[model samples]
Target: MSDIDRSPKAPDLYVHYCEHQGCDNWGSWGKSPSAAVATRWWCFEHFPHKSFDRNRR
Candidate 1:
């Protein structure tokens, strides 16, 4: 067998910040371009397309 490490590495943790200018809130919402990619992240207040149920929390 070859001496190559092929095991999957631990997932990288990324802390996304809001896309709005000067906003420091943690970006908990993600806008996906398609099923495979998330193009932008935003905080609850700055997120444009928030779900109705999300507001009830």
Candidate 2:
């Protein structure tokens, strides 16, 4: 069997806008795996004029 058939299928991955309510910005972001969980993720946004501390949460 090919790699696609050997491994369990993963659903399509998509970058959704940050779930921070009231902010409907279609974020052009990417997903990163959370350090605490293998199945969890963090979405990073590209805000050219702003600074963010990813480790602060």
Candidate 3:
């Protein structure tokens, strides 16, 4: 077998999102099942609900 074939397979990339509404940010959010379809996704400006909420408040 060639070295190319011996190389480890790349990790499967999944669609991740924030658990907020009306958000479609697909990326790492330090959450599990990161690739699963999420209820919502928060953009950089709308991440970390606690902070986002406080800012909105």
Candidate that would win on lDDT: 1
After TM-score superposition, the amount by which residue 52's alpha carbon in candidate 1 deviates from its true location, in angstroms, is 14
| Quality of model 1 by C-alpha lDDT | 0.80
What TM-score, to 2 decimals, does candidate 3 have? 0.37
How many residue pairs clash in model 1?
A: 0
Candidate 1: segments with Cα more than 4 A from true spot: 1-12, 35-38, 50-57
In angstroms, give how far residue 48 of model 1 lies from its true place.
0.7
- What ranking emerges by lDDT with the best candidate at the front? 1, 3, 2
Clashes per candidate, residues 3 or more apart or on different chains: 0, 0, 0
Give one digit per residue, the lDDT tens place, for model 1 in 10-55.
Answer: 8789899999899999999877656776568889998877463454
Off by over 4 Å in 2: 1-15, 34-57
Better of 1 and 2 by lDDT: 1
Model 1 earns a TM-score of 0.55
What's the CA RMSD for each of the models? 6.3, 6.8, 7.2
lDDT of 3 by residue, 1-57 (tens): 676676468788777675567666764544323356434444566567575456544
Q: How many times do residue backbones clash in model 2?
A: 0
